[model samples]
Target: MTETSTVLRTGRKFDQVLKGAREVFMADGFEGASVDDIAKAANVSKATLYSYFPDKRLLFREVVQTECGRMSEQILSMVDETQPAREVLTVAAQQLAAFLISRFAQQIFRICVAERDRFPELGRAFYEAGPRNGCKQLMDYLEKAIAKGELQIDDVELAAEQFSELCKAKLWMEVAFGVRTSVEQAEIDVVAHSAVDMFMARYGV
Candidate 1:
């Protein structure tokens, strides 16, 4: 059987189907979303949909993974290994924090939490696609910085997680709960710089 990821790159029709499915999933969420709705939205027969994605759960997982993968690519692309530690990290933190608090990100997170018990792999895939990828990208930057004698971190992985969490701090929870609908660039800048400051305080040489 062809996997969603494999078919994802095969042709235009596959792209259309997944894009349509993504819209339906985002609008209705996991449990509320129906295969019929997805097929209609995709303008494909149910058999066609199922051929690409074995089930609704698999479709949802692929949709979430696709979004996460795109975001991770953009976020990781923004990190420049050759830049100074503070400069590189400050930019990285700002972009990461912005993405984390965006409405779309929050919705994806909520969906994953709602479906996690029924479908643990979705949650694991979400974690792997976003946070784990973030941690690895940050760790790579930190490792490069350490090699250049720019940082003094003993545990790169923990530092990567801490720095990522630090960037989110108070705002992620607020955005996720609808306590606020959006964040200002100024506030993002403040949080990013603050996170970088704290991170460097511990690890900067």
Candidate 2:
């Protein structure tokens, strides 16, 4: 199904159903989550759930899109594009690192990869809402910084993408691979600061 045709309907309880689905999906994954369990968690009936989301895949797609949109909004609100590149990039890195280590990110990524063959739109939704959105935001900041002579970069898009990858340096792989189930604030800070330092080293004017 196409992205626009994914959801069947929306109502007052739409957010309620999504909340319950997100909780269940996070706990049990895509294949493991049950309609009964989701209905129970949402405090709604199966009929009510179906009215909002006719298919389980559609519900999952909605959850991914909603959560990723929320994260993107939060990131945009936290970072000021007018600030010095170091300060702006540090906040951005910290946010990116924290997002990378989140259970939501990990779970959604696994679900998309596992279900890609059957539901390619799921991966597209995740990428457009998550990484692609992030790069676009960062690219705007990089463009301003370049204009101010605070950074030297021929390719703002590449710099933005690199900055995101650099933010993932120490934490992303371990969290993604299940080697670490939890992460500490100190560790996140270390990765964020190191990413900023490295990014500046390569681009600072």
Question: In lDDT terms, which candidate is top?
Answer: 2
- Candidate 2 residue-wise lDDT, 70-144, digit = tens: 888888898887788899889888888999889899889998898889878778878987899889988888888
Over 4 Å off in model 2, which ranges? 1-10
lDDT of 1 by residue, 1-205 (tens): 4234443346557777788888887889888888899889999988888677776767766776788788877866877777899999998899889989976677778888998888777778778878898799889888989999999999999999999999889899888878988779999999999999999899999
What TM-score number comes out for model 1?
Answer: 0.91
Residue pairs in collision within model 2: none
> TM-scores, in order shown?
0.91, 0.92
Evaluated at residue 167, the lDDT of candidate 1 is: 89
**What's model 1's lDDT at 13?**
71
Candidate 1 displacement at residue 181 in angstroms: 1.0
